[model samples]
Target: MDTKKNIENISLLKEKMSDWRKLSDEELFLAVKEFEKMPRLEVSIYYQDLFNDPKFSKTLLDIYNKHKDNTKLVVLLVSAIGNMIQRYDLPESKEIYEFMLENSDKSKIGPYVAIFLPRLKNFESYDKKWEYFMNIKKMSPKKVAESSFETIMDLYLEKIPEHYKTEAIQYFNKKVEESNNEYGKQYYQDIINKIKS
Candidate 1:
């Protein structure tokens, strides 16, 4: 880790992030990017906490618009959108989620978007997101797992009709059998348990 970045991270995290609204959008983006040094799970919470002020929503949207084609940056943008949705329940997330599906692949930020898309009211049913997940299936196992498996499996287990739920389990089981990766098998099994119980 770069010591400069580490120091910057410590300084930023030390402050009350809600006060970060005073910072310009570029500064805010820098702060958000500083989170790259963190464990993946923590980044979203930091985003949620810091960017809660609705003023920053447009900042995030603008950043995402400008860098959507940059694969490295897009992950952070997707996490920011997910963070906002998780923390504030913002109503306008359909477009951000749509952008994720359009620009991201199945094995990358695609799974994260697949998971969150249903949270918006328009996706009360699972079909649209499900179709998108399948489209990304052409990616490698690691990629598909990264892109769709985690999110879509959870979606079926929680929200879909009973028949569809069983179907998802079966579908995942098939994938597990086809997969050479033991980790993927265990993952599918874990998902099966989550859905069943």
Candidate 2:
């Protein structure tokens, strides 16, 4: 049951998605257009449900490709992809992770990619997965180290490929030593110790 909603009107879209779960496919497309215009926090609140639907995912991905320079929308899109990756764990999401790597910034959506990419597994090698994490190193040192450390523990706990765990630890440790951000270093040390024990 689609409504005669104008997709270009952001406020109307948000109002319509006050109960987002009940939206029709056509209405959802409009909601996605609205979400593309939303702040990250609002998008995060709303898109969690949308990411569960494969159709919304593909649509959001298409929107993602369309908005390369639109950092806000891209972050929301990558977050949607990451949330879907975390929630569903289906299909090859290496491309999504790669997109995050190439397009997302550390101060922005990079942390999401840093943390989430380790969770995805494909039929083939995780060369791209590791490459994404390694690419995070080029971002602000303290933040990358701090954020990635958590994902390292997640990898260790998830038992995602023995070699992958090894690589995550090595990268995490290197960043910890290099970063002057003491809080980040302490946080990393705290989590790493917990994972070790």
Candidate 3:
């Protein structure tokens, strides 16, 4: 679906899912299990709205603990937990980070953890996190997978602070030069232009 349609769908879903906030812990896990069977984008839209409930963080971690062996769901859960950490002071953030750290060696998950794990400032100082994030050439992908180039670009575009924009653009330029993937090179150029403009 297009962006506008996705927003409308999420809004509609929010109306139905508001009751999800009030669900008991067990009930919430049941709800998550049902969500897991749905399309990824739809599941993402639903959980993105669901994460607004502070109570949901524990359930998110619980769900992670149960399903960490499922790499596809783990990616979604890691991203959700990362979003929750960014938006709230959840106690589960550290454990969630550790979980992602344990799974970071997987090809599909590594680039995502590389992108999202650095967002937690408690684990590392801001400068140190940026140093690590900027140095990961994998974050600027020559090949896209479940953790896609678009997703990585979007996260960097959304999360990059103003002070880091210049450094990010320079980094993108370097990736654009070194990458053999034509689409990846163009994507880097496009994002750099977006940052410039």
Candidate 4:
């Protein structure tokens, strides 16, 4: 899919969202599902609207509560919220971030946590982020490489303690060395260099 086109569509949808009351529940649900399938930036716009609309907000929260036990629904909800937290400067962003951290299942929380790390200022207080990184070390190196890239970028941007920086670099370097993909290796190397410089 063309991510740029998806972004444009999201912009259009945002404009139309002021008139969302015109859309039936089925239409609104389908629109949200379609937006979720779009590029990450596009998904964020829909999520932002959901949070902004009183009706949609109630609907979404109902859906979340109803399907909180369904892993697929949980993944979709958490991922959508994560995309919003990453893409926009919304007023409820921090509350949403804290909610995800507190409510999401530990096994399925890594990706959402990785997405939030770069935007946050301090890493030391978010011990779960570090714990997630350490736990993922047991996975295959490819999984390790792909999974940790965002987390490493977050660490690079955040005010991580000096002691953690060394461990973070070593962890990223190990992933880079194990990564078979040249692009992935280069991305980690660039992050390492950026952090070191």
Report every candidate's CA lDDT: 0.57, 0.54, 0.58, 0.54
Best by TM-score: 4
Give the runs in model 3 whose Cα sits over 4 Å from its true position: 1-50, 87-92, 125-135, 138-174, 178-197
TM-score of 4: 0.57
Per-residue lDDT over 10-77 for candidate 2, one digit per residue giving the tens place of the 0 to 100 score: 34554565555576645655566455443323234344444445554555566556556665566556
Error of 4 at 112 (Å): 2.9
After superposition on all CA atoms, what RMSD does each candidate show versus the true structure?
A: 6.7, 8.6, 8.6, 6.4
Q: In candidate 1, which residue ranges exceed 4 Å CA deviation? A: 1-31, 35-49, 88-94, 104-107, 125-127, 140-147, 158-171, 174-197
Q: Write the per-residue lDDT of candidate 1 for residues 40-118, one digit (tens) a residue.
A: 3333433343444445555556666765556556666666566556554544555665665565454555655654554
lDDT of 4 by residue, 9-85 (tens): 76565445435467775665555565555336444444454334434334444465645565555555555555554
| Total clashing pairs for each candidate | 3, 0, 0, 0
Quality of model 3 by C-alpha lDDT: 0.58
Question: Is candidate 3 or 4 superior in TM-score?
Answer: 4
The alpha-carbon lDDT assigned to residue 31 of candidate 4 equals: 57
Q: What's the true lDDT of residue 181 in model 2?
A: 92
1-197, model 3: which lDDT tens digit per residue? 67566656544443434465576656655555444332334334444544455555566666667666676666666665665555433444556667766755465666666656655555464445445554454532335332443454466676666787897787778879987999989978998998776
